[model samples]
Target: RVRLFLDVLAAVAHAHNRLILHRDLKPSNILVTAAGEVKLLDFGIAKLLHDATVPAAATEITKAAGRAFTLQYAAPEQLQDGDVTTATDVYALGVLLYVLLGGVHPTAAFTTAPLDQMRAVIEAEPKRLSDAVLLNSAGGAAAVKLKQARALRGDLDNIVARALKKAPTARYANAALLADDLRRYLNDEPVTARPDAIGYRSAKSLRRHRLGVAAGSVVVLALTVGIGAALWEANEARQQRVQAEGLIEFMLGDLRKKLQPVGRLDVLDAVGAQALAYYAAQDAGRLDADSLGRRARALHLIGEIAERRGSLDEALRVFQRAADSTAELMARYPQDGQRIFDHAQSVYWVGYMARQRGQVPDAEASFRKYQELAQQLTRLDPNKLDWRIETAYAAQNLGVVYLESSRSAQALKAFVETRDAWAGIVEARPEHGFELGNTWGWIAKAREALGEFDAALDAQRTKIDVLRKLPDADKNRIVQRHLAIAASELARLQLALGRYPLAGRAGQDAVDKFEVLVATDRANAEWLAQMTLARVILAEIQLALGERAAASASLDRVAADTVRLRSTDGTRNKWNITLLGSLLLHRLALAESPAPQRQDLEAYLATVESAVSGGKPLDAEQTRIASAVELALGDLLARDAQPAAARGHWQGAAERLQATADRGELPSMTLLAQARLRLGAKAGARSLAQRIEVSLYRHPAYAELRQRLAAAAGAAPGTP
Candidate 1:
């Protein structure tokens, strides 16, 4: 059964490497297959890092601190919104182990209380094992069976208690450590489990000795002289056993009160490393492959934390070492395919993180090998939504690679295929609502790229509605995302028809929502860039309303912020550059001076045109930037007397911008109409103008746009 659990732990650890959080883990979720192997099941409430919905701002409201897992097995922070680091999983695993050995829940003996209530009791003080034994002997239903609890040969009670520590920082740093302590207890070596206090241990030891003496005295009537000797020996043996239990319990308790959380807990500073090292060294020669695999997982988690903190090089090395170590362990124990699969995943993670540095080839090769290993996982018959998702994910990422390499046609195919695969996964597994939302959202983007606006809108709407159906408590970023997409789509359609105010309001809503996110944390490069672009669009529409001063203020702010964020890391932060260029172009178009402004704006516009046409995953904010830049470029060219080129640019910009249905598209369309009128194409210009009128009337941002288009239609050709 312990081996079955060890296998389950390895599988769970592998899932964690992929950023899946198993919110429910207990004895029932752990099962033994017919082949005598353990299978971990039930990710019904798991949280995936790669969600489909547009992410929202991180607020205290969305924290997953307390509420998912069973209270009897939940970590302390899992009671409140404290720090629910991965160590919480380790705590739950310990509870599972306790139940497997003792035949009853550790906290269950105390009360069938809520997690918060249990956590308070765990933190306050623990009932002594001797007292628990006394309670059991007294026929108390509230107490666990002493004989059954003693199934664990040495220091088991203290081991369980330590792992169930209320504070995450005070528990085993991770599952690996908890397992190590368990192994030590099994081996009759010293463990970290401790009593509530030394005084408690002494009192318990004395009580046990007195009990042994009393038992021994029952046989004293037959041989008075030898009875004294028998009683003394019994008391001595009892004292030795009690002292060993006390010592082991104290050691475990001390360690539990100081372990790091599952991730690279920096607060432990060097203590985490030292404590882990101590455990590793204690049974270095005795570790089986399962033990080694668990260690590798712990090391992998540490690497991830380091990577998140910007120490990429350190993370790379750590992941490399862990992968190597796990590989060797798997080679020695070929039967443990699950752990070996996990080792392959750790190597793939190292490659995935490397992609962020623009190392395309290395990342590609890594994912390719990862795909091969993950394919084998399909045959393993993983519980559900198993390793196949990893294969699909690898495909999606590879497709992103093609997109980045200027292969839009190929990129489009990959994204579509990936989207389909995800859809199938969601369909087959509807319980993973988050995954369903994400797959649907990406599919909408793909449909939009294929010029299927209605389909795209439907897809987006589906994503939003799915999120809305979820409880507000579980909505998190999805709710805000629904609103953001709604505002963006509404603005786009309204602008296409010349509804300036409606378009303006819709765009302004997106800007306002994003701005609140930006104020919380400017450190997120992506969010900062997005906030800037949103502000630029809002300003552009404001200017179109003839609010020149307000528009100028918004543009000035965008320019200032983007300029500061500009650096050599431009490729990765390309959206920042796009925002900068678009802001400059908008400023030039509305500038009091004409000559110098036109030159600067034209240069930026040319660069953006090259980039977009060359095939990039057009980020939403950057897409808006490109649209505005092209619009300004066409207007400037027409005003400067380049009629043919002006007409060509305007026609192209108008058609492309119309695809977005953005409110800004209307102004560009009007400009295109003016260019056609100048080129002596009266019928063509009127046709385009009529289409704009009809489109505006149908838009949610329609009322303001109807007036603008109606007045434009009444005006003569070539009139301002």
Candidate 2:
């Protein structure tokens, strides 16, 4: 097979030049033709000299060779000087020949030696093939036979040695010359490979060639023997490896999937991930495209599983394999990117998974790739709103990642770019219209964080207006989601600006919408959570208005829903809900005016702290609430003379509240003012009290607080 492959290589080279130096020769890029011809490939990277023409078909120019090829096949001068000559190709060809005939390169286990060591081996000396036979000989006649081996009969080792000369000046100048030498030896002539040649120069050449052949041949034979022995024992072990792997994965799949319920949210994912990993390893070398597709599907399944489990690393690997498989499929059918997109959403998920793992670079790469795919879809069908929407979504999420990392400036830039890109998407194209609102909502949040409240209001109002403009008949689940988001943001803005009644109205409107959705879809966890959150906000406003009974009722509703959620789900998953509900309950207790309920407020606040410390996923609102609860609890504890605990909680609350104030997001003017007053920062308190007076006097929801402030105003004119 190798002999045939070499014939093909010679033919291929001849097509380009009388002597094309295929310098970077190795087994990896060489293939055996069916007729036993050697087919050489990757000549695009090979060196072409004076005799070689640049092919008309070649499109790009790259560097010529030296040690640019594999180090193992590199000729000594080529390694040292980046030299290019036909003899360099001849040297690499010799290495290839040694490997083809011997089952290994002419070295121990075919390990790549260093350049200097390899140079020494190729240049320093050579040993005769006859010397090797003589070393292995049993008697005198066999030793004599060993001495004349290449001369009396063609020795592949001797043929290789002459071609492998380290010094280009000493080597066969081209493949044709080496082939001629081998042919002469094969015909049993007084060959130039024999040490006792007719002429002095020929005799000297033959002696060196014969010596190198003998040394290289010894290494080859040892390798051949070891390989043969291993193959002889591998038949059963190979079958067992395959069988054992199959049985184990199958058993694991059975055990792992036993308790999983049908129609479970993660059903497709859990089964798929385990199956995909099993198949990918099992079919790495699989030739059948159908089999490879199945393996890819398994990987896709695994990706789905990982996404559901929030195992971003596992999901990324799975989705990458799916992409690879699709690429392979596309190689057989160029312009088949559409076919890959037709499969499950691996591309978007890969980007999402990358972001989840905090692999920002990887996430950006995946997102760019996804955008390229989306662009293809757009070009193929410009009316494809989903494609444009997906591209915009990727950009938005990336922007969110930036925002969360405190790169607000960068995030604003990204979101603005995304908004512009999506703006061309028609408003009638409902698939993407909701995203417009969502994008604007995020832009508003960014502006709000930057203390640009007017800009924030404009951004938020644009979202609300656009969403409200949609026809009532066109309004669906997504429309509701957008409305909820916009209303929530507006509520926050109003709350920030001391328009407590307006904030309460906006928050209540969002809650009303979510409540309607929850009534229709009982199991929609997000909607349920949002409804509960709205109640908490309303309860807070009511508490400020001194509508103690209404505030208590709202708190009661939040507690009931949160307790139900916590009872059904694991505490680990429901802690955020629990914390928010508990905080509201504490606020209700504090506002009750009755002395006994104050004890209940203290207990509720303690629970909020414990929930946070236990690693629950609390949002910024919940975090603020927890801080306030701790502060109030601390103040109560301090009044009772537990100075140490009171000091710790108050100090922590003050720090957190200060951060919020710094961001200009805190909703508490009066509480913050009083907090400053208690901490003896009278100047800060007085400033905060002026802001509190705006909320108290102008916000109808805090009319009672306004009255209290008026009385306090006379008692201490500038006091918090």
Candidate 3:
């Protein structure tokens, strides 16, 4: 029976790798030939997860004229969210396994009534397999039922129950993991479904070595008559475990907060090493639940320290291990709030590491699980501020993923939710000051992605204001870093709207903060990258203000830093677009002669255009930068008195910009309007400008875009 299940799992795992999901998996959909070959039959409702043709919100199959799922096998998430995820098929597989082993459907008792059946699928916990086997007479006889019950009473019971969990996050992540646990059980190995409890492991070992043990008179364990010595050894190990836990707690809880302001945590390297060595010395299977929990937490701190020190491979390895350990611990005590909370952090960290590695789909899955776990914790205790804060973090992380993927509308929704959650959290606990800045920053990023520059600027200002409210804002490294980032982002939005004066002020503020940080931490690659980015944007603001010498100086100062970052740290820090923009702007600043300089600009623009259009795939941010470079070349052509050619470039750039949805870039829009005017479409230009003015109404930064719009209205065609 397990072999048949494994065959089905292989097919499902293959589909998942191709980003396909079988939304309606059931017995009728799977078939076995008379020759005992397995076949997966139906894919009428299969959902393609990664297809560009499919709408992001339409990942689930349409019921069309009726419901699609076999009510007995539908996962709770599938019923509730109408989403087809990998977990949906795993749930169906679990139901199939349950029926094959226990000879009855797990939901048979309460799912008789049609109305109640849907509710049971969505809300009711399925009956335990052991209990169901005794109650149902689907097997040959009462003796057969009892025999099946005995077989599935322990690890098998846990494995099936985990797959049938009401929350998709609580279930096996995929069919492959579910099959792995079953395989482990068959091979007499410790199955992941159960925690590494001593008694369970000892029983398994005894089963595998019973004859050998009987030959040796219960092996060495029974022959040893010194209970006092065993007690002493146990006591010594308990002492060591307690000491390790205390050390880990201090490092993770209090020391971590302190070190955030101090610098990279090289000081804690020895401490992390000690904790790891202590845990490694013990046999994990013999550790109690508390010791396992301690080990899990220690691994998390070690991963964090490794991440801080720029050891990404080690960090991800430790984080994944911690996550797996925490999952097992949570499985052992599914209802414990502390266990649930610990598991949530582990899931989140694993997702964070995956995102850092650019494995976005894996990150999204882990983040979704983190969100589910957070929601579960919230339901477990609505008034618990810690759990509520975790929910906010969950929303924030999901918004980050959506923003990274260029799903701006969905990202904005998630960021707004995160901001609202933080708002409520701040009102309840004013001491959670750091979150105030970060939440608004996320909202700013989401709005920026949607081309709502005015709204994004407002959010950035709020972030700066809240960051400044920290008691140690000036002295604290983290607070100052956030303040600088907020200010730098504010400057970019201001520049995007053509607000020169405000952009200069914001940009200078960011530069001032960054200069201080860089001076103190010259060896820090991440800080150096961030500081360079601030200067690059500052230079762009300088160019817009026509401060030629200042812009040139700033660009020169950051040129080496930009090169170093792009070569060494680009993948980790992700400021490639801004740095590329800085390079283009610098070239624009130096292009004084018409013919000679125009060739350089044209060639550079062609290269950028090709890169964005088809040469290499880019994230939305880099693609927008390429579009901006096209417009810059048009400006140069217009300045050199090539009116017709300038208009052609401007028209092409305008359409490209529109496709990229970067209408918030006021200079690009100005060029677009001018191009339309040159083409004798005055009304079209006026209408576009009017629509923008309306969209940007009531924002304080609205004046910048409005002024640009007015200039476009007054300008003659081909005027640079």
Judged by lDDT against the true structure, how good is candidate 3?
0.70
lDDT, candidates in the order shown: 0.56, 0.57, 0.70
Order of all candidates by lDDT, from best down to worst?
3, 2, 1
lDDT (tens digit, per residue) of candidate 2 on 1-720? 334545744654463343245667777767767776667767756654542466644412424334366776667776576456666777777766655543344432335457555655555543443343444334257646555444323455556666665456445555655565565444433223322222433333444566654566677746644554455345234323433332333223332243222213343444454565455566454333433443454465556555444344466777887777766654554554444453324566677765544445556667677667667766766765666666677678768766644456677888998888777775556556666777888898777666566788899999888777666723476677668767777776776666778887887887777776666544444456667766766776666556777777777788787765544333322334344545444454555544434466566556555645654334444545656566566767888898887777766666656655554442444445445555656567667556645432233323433344445456632333
What lDDT score is found at residue 334 in candidate 3? 87
What pairs collide in candidate 3? none
What shift in Å separates residue 607 of candidate 3 from its native position after superposition? 12
Where does model 2 exceed 4 Å of error?
Answer: 1-391, 402-410, 427-430, 451-455, 469-475, 567-582, 585-619, 658-660, 666-675, 684-720
- Summing lDDT over every window of 10 consecutive residues in candidate 2, give the lowest-scoring window: 254-263
Which scores higher on lDDT, 1 or 3?
Answer: 3
Model 3 alpha-carbon miss at residue 322, Å: 1.9
Residue-pair clashes per candidate: 16, 17, 0
Better of 1 and 2 by lDDT: 2
lDDT per residue for candidate 3 within 82-174, as digits (tens), equals 555677888888888888887777775533887677777775556788888898855668888788789888888888987786556556666
